[model samples]
Target: MEEESMEEEGGGGCEAMMDDQNHNNWGAGGYGRHLLGPAAAPLGNSLLRGPAAGPTADPELSDVPEANGVLRGCEPGKGGAGAIAAAININASTSKFLMNVITIEDYKSTYWPKLDSAIDQLLTQSPGDYIPISYEQIYSCVYKCVCQQHSEQMYSDLIKKITNHLERVSKELQASPPDLYIERFNVALGQYMGALQSIVPLFIYMNKFYIETKLNRDLKDDLIKLFTEHVAEKHIYNLMPLLLEAQSTPFQITPSTMANIVKGLYTLRPEWVQMAPALFSKFIPNILPPAVESELQEYAAQDQKLQRELMQNGFDRGDQSRKRAGEELTYNGSSACASSRGYR
Candidate 1:
């Protein structure tokens, strides 16, 4: 009876040990399953294949290393580390790209002054003054300003510069002597247009993208209109009488000078010369005397005859110079020959 009781106790002990072993194996499999999803099945199967299998001697237990490697791959920081690193790198690159973008405020403070100075030089430069304008640098500034959506401000500033310059020109014209009036005014116009030839290209981006788009007007046309309003029209009453008096003086003012003034007026406002104020309409009939017209015609004929005589005189002078040059060359040659031939 004592031996049988001892055997029964041993059997119970064995059963409890098997249950504890199964429980430990289940816990490990459960941990892997929770973290690794379907991949943990092999771990569980290897550990819990049969009740009789020993903890360390099972054939399926050989696959535990591979399963552990897979678990390590799916581990929180270990498995997804490469992807996380890549994401971090992408975010850093994106931030760097955004930092390099040029903002409107930055462009205004840095690049705009270059353009303003260029315009100022153009407006204020004297005759024969050399303005050192860098086309590429100025163009880049304008391009950047336009790209940053600052084109409207650029256009407005340019218009203001031109208007102010023209106002100053008008004052100078008013102060000039009547005989020098047209000549001075024409010189001013020429300078203004010459400066614009340099300036217009720099502002072309603004003119095309902003001015034309928003205002539906051309830059050159606007400049001409401003000239008409601020200069030509403003000084018309002061300028017209002088122009007519100059036109009547045949020997004094050339026909080309009168034509240029008329053409300049027409260019400013097409109808102003002929129709708007009928510039010569009442002037010729009412203001100018008939005796002056007859005298002007006679003076014009005399002027043409004098010009022909002057041209003939110029030709005669040129012929005389050529003959003198030939004579000199012959004398020089003869002297050279005499010296070379041992003649005194």
Candidate 2:
């Protein structure tokens, strides 16, 4: 009876030793399974069960306290399996976030057109005309575009739109009657700037972020530069003459109109106002009344005396007199004479 009891005790010790060895082997195989994927699963199972899974790999062995811990750890509710599921969920959430992010092209196509239309309406609409789009919608669209790295492209498009509009304004000025050119230009500039005043608030975010940060200039400065390039530069020569004419002779333009032009130029950029001295120096001679110098009576008499002698010498007196009278001899002769005189 004592031998029998000793043999049973030895068997139990061997079972415990086998369980411990299986647990250690299983722990090591867990890492291998992760590194090697499904191809290593059979190897890990053979190591966990010791060469072959048979009668010795008792299903009941999993009921042991240590085995229960390992089994429970692998269940969907806990341990590495749970961690894997959580990681998957986190990745899915991140993918969803990335999918929802707005792209620059999206803003350019969707929101930017709406903003451009509103700008056009503001620029071209008559005063007191109803504008269908609200300012808030424009602000939101601009905010979204700037937040999504669409600023530079949007700003470039804005410049093109404004420049095209100003080009049209310049053409109108070019076609205007010479006396009305300054007035038309001033009216166009006022309309453009006033429209910009209404439109600027909508792009405040872009002005603060993209324009200020990337270009080191504000939107207002960029707009002024566009005006300089497209409108002011193109018509500057003609504009300067008309402006000087207007300033000297207010009968050609209202005092208020001239004042507005001056104020608008000063407000747009101090550089523009500063250019006045240079423009005056360059253009004043063209616009100014021709200087009248009294000719010496003796020299004029000598010239007339020479002309009479030529005629007396039978140089066709009627033809000579007609030539001396300075009649326009060709269709463009009068225009050539006027051009030589000064701005008319």
TM-score of each: 0.53, 0.52
Reference-based lDDT, each prediction: 0.58, 0.59
- Per residue, candidate 1 scores C-alpha lDDT tens digits across 47-125 of 4443332233334333333333343322222222232123222234333323433465655666667788888897777
The segments of candidate 1 whose C-alpha lies over 4 angstroms from its true place after superposition are 1-104, 125-129, 254-256, 275-344
Tens digits of per-residue lDDT, candidate 2, 121-229, equal 9889766778887776677666655655677788888888888888888888888988677877887887787787887787887787767866798887778777877
Best by TM-score: 1
Q: How many pairs collide in each candidate, listed in order? A: 0, 0
Candidate 2 versus the native: TM-score? Answer: 0.52
Tell me how far the alpha carbon of residue 6 in candidate 2 is from the true structure, in angstroms, after superposition: 84
